[model samples]
Target chain A: MTPKISRFFAEHRPATPCLVVDLDVVESRYQALHHNLPSARIYYAIKANPAPQILRRLTELGSSFDAASIEEIRMCLAAGATPDRISYGNTVKKVSAIREAHELGIDLFVFDSMEELAKLAEHAPGARVFCRLTVENEGADWPLSRKFGTTTTHARELMLRAATMGLRPYGLSFHVGSQQTSVTAYETAIARASALYRDLQDEGLDLQMLNLGGGFPARYREDVPTIGQFCTAISQALTEHFHNDLPDILVEPGRYMVGEAGVVSSEVVLVSRRGGAPTDPRWVYLDIGRFGGLAETEGEAIRYTFRTPHDESDPDHSPCVLAGPSCDGVDIMYEKARIPLPNSLRDGDRVDILATGAYVSTYCSTGFNGFPPLAEHYI
Target chain B: MTPKISRFFAEHRPATPCLVVDLDVVESRYQALHHNLPSARIYYAIKANPAPQILRRLTELGSSFDAASIEEIRMCLAAGATPDRISYGNTVKKVSAIREAHELGIDLFVFDSMEELAKLAEHAPGARVFCRLTVENEGADWPLSRKFGTTTTHARELMLRAATMGLRPYGLSFHVGSQQTSVTAYETAIARASALYRDLQDEGLDLQMLNLGGGFPARYREDVPTIGQFCTAISQALTEHFHNDLPDILVEPGRYMVGEAGVVSSEVVLVSRRGGAPTDPRWVYLDIGRFGGLAETEGEAIRYTFRTPHDESDPDHSPCVLAGPSCDGVDIMYEKARIPLPNSLRDGDRVDILATGAYVSTYCSTGFNGFPPLAEHYI
Candidate 1:
């Protein structure tokens, strides 16, 4: 937990199953990214956490936004971000959403398929559009390959078609995937996108941007590459591929900016051995689970580290099946990971799930099994 | 689609990505379950769809409720259900929830472990408690066995312990699983529970109820056994085990009660061949996805059939990967299933996902990706 969150919890004693985000951490992360990648324009992916507080902070920091829906564009506007700084980032958008975004003055939009390109041409005529390229998400914890992007050949045809259809084929974009751990994944994607950028430029399309879509990692149970390391690799790749003729670099960072800034403070609801066998792992139920904003825990992909009041007092730990306090069986967060929690853990003991700022609160079910959405506390 | 829902859509032309529930189907389902299982008292699991309209209707039909949390209990009460008609069904709960339920005059509770029994004893003193038994979920589409319940031996000990902890050992309960297709699973669970019941009875504890917890299936992509078949199987099992000394049967039906009663009407956002290969399956993006409320589609576990305007008009069909309109890759619902949709399906075409009344609306993320929670309408 950050010092801010720790101090807030000590003084306030807020209710359990709440997320506490340290705005200081968010600002520092933004500074670190900006400092390291000086040439890149950072677009805060608001889908990660669209809290007005965070948006306002990023807006004041001069950070642009990449919105998945028009609701997000409205949120950015509410946060004082100009429509020009907001990019309609999602490739799959309704015609109405396209028209709405265009009317709202958001000029930049993304598309991968021909149908979406057509929608953009008709609904937001003459708008700047970027075609997303299908790239292998080899090193991402959560692969985003199959459902998005298009083959290079398809993207080329779509971009050429976009210009003919009176749309500005302004750039190319690709996501390595979310929670991407390897810097080489960025290197690989850059190489692929740069080659395509040259091809599109040769084909007479004035591609002004190389969109490095969000796949930034957050520290969870394991440490990840520092922002500097990722930036160094990214910078080196840009130099090797662009030969000093670099396009305007745009990096969308969702998980990285606010991920390490928050902690989910949940109380243990129950601790027991379901089978009553000595060999069985103890089941520890928390007030929060998958539906309670830990949706990233699906398939045990993003393993979050935990902090308990007994962490120091009771040093001994044992394997436990961690689950949310829901009646549904699939609500389990980490059974396969077999998280080793402190042996002294008891019902009502506060367990802090660290690095949960981004993508946690927003993914919460409205009230699954009568458990309300994860409460937010921005410190 | 139900006649009522079809009529509603035809008349209103409600916005895309909304849920329309036919109240008539919910009532007919209640009547069917009641008529088929005369011995079983229906406890409509409010966690499935806690819409006040359904709750009030069920309340008027004299249906009891199995609430997963205090909020659900409060909702049931708000719908005019008496405290006596509600049972706190989740085994994992906070002490605050226990105290609140007790204060609300809820007398019946379910538990699977010692820690929970103690909480009930301390907070809801002298409340009737039922032990949940861990049973094999052999034929369930969404197996719910591992996260809940305990072994028969453990349950026996827990019930015996409940009596000493100032609680009544009311009965035993078991969930075969959700969307369970086999009637034999209920038979097997009943046999196991009855054996434990007799053993506990010999030890001088009177168990008066047997909760055959919810697992009742809703028709999805495939047909499931009718309510009459499951009731017949359960009746035979109870007769064989109890030998005319039958206890009060309690059945909690979450999915069956309303699963088939609702339809999610969504518009096709985009449809494309991403790979640009003739052999490649088309990707169909809908306005609503897993985050929007079709959470049961996770793991492709609950395969919902769809109806499109082009279904008949186009005549020709081709395999397609159905996905939600989220930038996230995991938002893709049915790639493995390769649902065959109309070849002529185009963007903005209305597609109706059927049998989604239960468990769909409640699991929707508040606004993941800035897409608002699935709107609901009752006809």
Candidate 2:
């Protein structure tokens, strides 16, 4: 936890299952990215955590936004961001949403298919649109599938078609994946996007931007490469691929900007062995669970580091199956990859899940099984 | 879709990504269960879909409730259910929640471990409690792990401990699993609970209730056994085990009570081939996705049947990868088990996902990726 969040928890002793975010941590992370990758314009992906306080802070820092929906675009606008500073980044767009965004003076959009391109041409006419290129998500913890992006071959055709349909074929974009660990993933994606960029240039279309969609890493159970390392790798790739005629770089980072700034403080609800021998792992249930915002633990993929009050004083620790307080069968967070918690942890004890700032609050079900959404506090 | 829901859609033409539930279907389903399991007291599991309309109707029908949390218990009370008609059924619960529910006059609680039993004894002293026995979840679509229940050997000890701590060991309960398909699953659970009941009786603790916890299936893509078949199997098992010494049976039915009563109407946001061969499946993006309430599609466990506007007119239908309209990678609903959509399907077309009445609304993220929660409408 950040020092600000740690201090907030100590003073307020806020209710359980609440997220405490340090605003200073968010600003520092943004500045680190800005200093490291000076050439790239950072478009904060607001879908990661669209807290009003976080948005207002980023807006004051002059950060652009990459919105996943019309509501997100409005959130950015509501936070004092101008319409020109937002990009509708999701490739799939509803016709009404497209029209609403267009009428709201949002010109930039994204698409990977002819159908979406056609909708853009009809609804948001002359909007600057980017074609998403299909790329590998090898090293990402939350690897994306072929649910998005198109092959470079198909993207070429789509860009040409967008121009013919009176839409501005502005750029090409690719995401290695979310929580991407390997910098090589970005290198590979840049090369693919650059090849497509050159191919489109030869076709008499000058793409203005190369959108490096968010794949930035956040520290969880393991350490990841620093922001400087990612920026250096990205900077070198752009120099090698585009040479003297480098296109304007646009990086949409969601997780990296705010992930480590927050900690989820939860109360231990129940600790049970369920009739097992002492060798068996005990099940530790917390106030928060999959429905309460830890949806990333669907397959035990994002293993989070945990802290309890007895961490230092209690010498004995044991592996336990971590779970949420919901009655749903699938509310389990970590079962296969058992979490080692202090043996003294029991009901009413405080447990804090670290680095849960970005996704936890938003991913929470409004009130699944009658449990309210995860509460959020930005200090 | 039920005629009422179909007609409601025709008349209202409500916004996309909304769930419409027909209350009459819920009543009929309740009546079906009531008729089939005459000896068993039906406790409508409020966690399935705790809509006020559904709860009030069930309350009017003299149905008891199995609440997962204090909020759910409050909802049941607001719907006119007396505290005596409610049972706090979640095995894992916070101490504060136990105190709150006990103060609200909720006397019945469930537990599977010693730790949970102690909390109940201290917070809800003299209350009636039941021990949950861990049973195999064979032939269940959404099979539960050993997350909520204990072994019979452990439960026997816990019940004995409850009695010693001045709490009534009211009953024994077991869940085969959610969306359970096999009739034999209930039969097996009943047999296990009966064996425990007899063992506990021999030890001088008379258990009054046998909770046949919910595992009832909703018809999705595949047809499950009729409710009659399940009730018959349960009835036969109870008779075989208890003979002339029948106990009060409590059946908690969640999904089976409301799954068929609702339909999720969604707009086709984008339909893309993603530059694939003509033979390759198309990607169908809906206004709603995993975060929008189709969370049961996580591992494609609950395969929902779909109805498009072109289903009847279009002769050519092809397999498609179905996804939600969020930018999240995991939002893709069906990829491996491709859903068949009309070849004519495109943007702006309406698709109705069937049998979503139960888990969809409750499981929806508050607003993942800036999309609002799935709107609910009860007719």
Candidate whose lDDT is highest:
1
For residues A274-312, what per-residue lDDT tens digits would candidate 1 score against the true structure?
Answer: 877868779999999999899989999999999888887
Judge candidate 1 against the unseen true structure and give its global Cα lDDT, from 0 to 1: 0.93
List candidate 2 segments past 4 Å from native: none
Estimate the TM-score of every prediction: 0.99, 0.99
- Candidate 2's displacement at residue A210, Å, is 0.6
Chain A alone, TM-score for each of the models?
0.99, 0.99
Can you write out model 2's per-residue Cα lDDT over B78-123, one digit (the tens) per residue? 9999999999999988888899999999999999889899999999
Q: What CAPRI class is candidate 2?
A: high
Q: Evaluated on chain B only, what is the TM-score of candidate 2?
A: 0.99
lDDT by residue (tens digit), candidate 1, B1-379 = 8778888999999997899999989999999999999988999999999999999999999999999999999999999999999999999989999999999999999999888898999999999999999998999999999899998888988899989989999999999999999999999999999999999999999889999999999998888999999999999999999999999999999999999999999999999888778887799999999899988889999999999988877889999999999988899899888899988899989999999999989899999999999899998
How does residue A133 of candidate 2 score in lDDT?
A: 87
